[model samples]
Target: MAAELMRETWSGEVSVVTIGAAKSEGGTRSAMVKIGGQKTLPFLFAEGAIPHKPVIALEIWDIAPLDWPEESTKPYGQSIKDPLAWAQMCVKEFKAQLLCVRLQGAHPDFGNKSAQQEAEFIKALLKKVDVPLIIKGCGDDEKDNQVLAVCAEAAKGERCLIGSAVQDNYKTLVAAVLADGHNIIAESPIDINIAKQLNILISDMGLPLERIVIDPTIGALGYGLEYAYSIMERARLAALSGDKTVASPFICFIGQEAWRAKEAKVGSADQGIMWEVVTACALIQAGGDILVMRHPKAVEKVNKYIEELFIPR
Candidate 1:
């Protein structure tokens, strides 16, 4: 007799959040990316529906990244000096499906750009790229509160995914995102409980649970990746088990974490690329919906890897 096959079923689905709006939706994006709405674990199609594939977002800064190693900067060349050109290169040359604009220049230590300046930058970027966007703020809470709110309003109706609402400072961004018709990213310090709490807090402010993405603050390989993966795995399992508050899609900042590792900077360019590729691949399997990455070569390899994973068995 043939052995019986066992398939696990879940009682809940991850919230499906769509980024960007096309002409039909009253925005200028040529295409929109939809994430989440999974009924099972990542890539277990036989078990349940996996609706949308994980998306890869290339990171571009408002100002030139001063600390990036040569391997990371060589991809864009002169485009790095101009955020608009950098975004264009990612889309045109790298074929990036999504773009993440990091307003690092608005940070106090970076350039202290006013909220108005950041808002203008977001406006210019929208005119330059037609793909969905993920706008992230610099780490300064005070400055982020000022800048992200303005940027959120500036990109109104565009349906961008703007982050990040942390436990300590979420209300401003949450309110802005809610008012602007954009999704919000809830970030936690790699703690599952905190992640859940922040999500609930953001939702409490009138933003639907479906419009929120979770950022568990993952670490790169060799830098506590195992612990980060464990947290994400647990979160996914909880969501599958019917935990609504934690059922949001996960967005892992893969490049930001991957490039910071000492190994990526100390080795050959190939080594750095591999570090990013491996980090991204691991997180996606752990149920990451959006991966914000750097380095076109790394993104290229990871895109091929995603294609291979999605191939029917």
Candidate 2:
């Protein structure tokens, strides 16, 4: 006889919250992407519901990545030398629906480009790709505030997703986003409580609940991944069980985590590439709505997992 199914009955409820805007909807994308609507645990297809398939976003940076390992860059080649060309390839070749370009050179030490400089680079990338764009900072609180606010105004009406608003700079960032009119990715450093707090802080800034996206930070497998999974799972549970603050769409910085960790994507052939795939699949299984990953293998593996788990009603 076939083994009994391991799935158990679940009882929960969650509001449907969609992120991103379309060109017709006033953004510059062909279609808007939506995530975060669950009535039960991850992929309880019979019980829980998935409104939109999880989205994959390819990450790029403004300047040539001086720090990326050769293995990853070898695949990118001369394309990496030009940000616009790189963004073009990520969307055209990789079929990435979202293009996230981090302003790495804008950091105080690294070129310290002003808001106008960031805006020009962003506009250039925007012209290169038709997909929705996500702009991130170099994690400097004060500089992030100054640049992001100006960026918000510069990208106005296009409805780009401006991000990484943390607690210390939430007031300035949130107010600017509100006035300039754009969506946000509220950021927290791998803590559930901190994640919820950032969401609340943004909401308190008068930003509507639907326009917010949460990034709780990620640590790849064998590098505090267990903690990330537990925290993500718990957040999903709370959101589905009707905790409004935790219901926002969650985004994961998969590349940052997977590449930095020694286990899978970084090590030698003896290290086994399968581990990286497993690590990525584990994150999808752990309730990640959007996996912002760099390696094509990781995206392929995660895409397969989503395909297997999503069964029609």
Candidate 3:
């Protein structure tokens, strides 16, 4: 008799989350996209159904990213000078499933913009694009709470994903999202236990697991990325294996890390040739559900790899 192939079976429940609010469903966007309606492990299409496919958001900065490598950013040319035009191009050209406008420059020293200025831009953004909007803050605990609250209200009833809710300021930000009736991303710094803990804390505020997305923090390729990868993998595995509190879908800032790493930033055949390509592909394979990427080229390339891997024969 021939030996039989063995496979593990899981008898546990998994959570499915729909991130964006559709227009007919009551938002400005024509449609909404959610990443995790998976009933099995990532990319296990044959094992169970994946109700919502992975969605990619093109990242735009409220201010030009001073840190991005010129080579990595050259494609956008001078369009980075205007957030509105850049956003228009991202939707009309590259086909962004969603748009994330980072208010990184809204800091007084950065953009010298007021809360009013930030809200103006956000309201302008909602008017400019019909895609489900994700409004992110500049990672400041106190400032983000104030700014994001104003922002959530500005995009009120759009049901956008409004957040950057951290442990330090989750209460303030969470209150804002609830008040505005928006979904949010609860960002924790790459610790599985901490991620779960934050989830519980936010859940305690009465936001269902379905209403929030988890950011586990990505480490760039060849830059301590393995630890980030392992944490995400384990988190997914634990979720599939019956960790109810942690079963919310995961998000990774792939482009942010890709460019943050030395290799992806380099512009030479000797240093950066194919590095972004290699790194982005690996993250997708490592249980990353939503990848926030920068370059159009990398997004197109890695998306192909994802299709080949995630879709069943």
Compose the digit string of candidate 1's lDDT tens values, residues 110-140: 9999999999999999999899999999999
Note each model's CA RMSD in angstroms: 0.8, 2.7, 1.9
Candidate maximizing TM-score: 1
lDDT per residue as tens, model 3, 1-313: 9997565566553566555566676667777776776667667666767677666778899888888777666778888888898898888888888888889987666765667789999989888888888888887666787788898889888888877887777998888888888887888788888889988999899888777888888777787678888887787788778787777777777777777777665557323425566666666666666777778777777677777775568
The CA lDDT of each predicted structure is: 0.93, 0.75, 0.77
List candidate 3 segments past 4 Å from native.
Answer: 267-273
Cα deviation at 162, candidate 1, in Å, is 0.6
Per lDDT, the best of the predicted structures is: 1
Candidate 2: minimum summed lDDT over ten consecutive residues — where?
264-273
Task: List, residue by residue over 1-313, the lDDT tens digit for candidate 2.
Answer: 9997775444544444444466666666665666777667777776656677777788888889887656556556799989898888887777887877788888988889998898787767666778877788878888888888887777766666778888767888788778867778888888889989988889987998777888878777778878888888898888776788888777788776666666654557423235556666777778777777776655667677778777564
* Per-model TM-score versus the true fold: 0.98, 0.90, 0.93
Kindly give the stretch of ten consecutive residues in candidate 1 with the minimal lDDT sum. 265-274
Better of 1 and 2 by lDDT: 1
Tell me the lDDT of model 2 at 280. 67
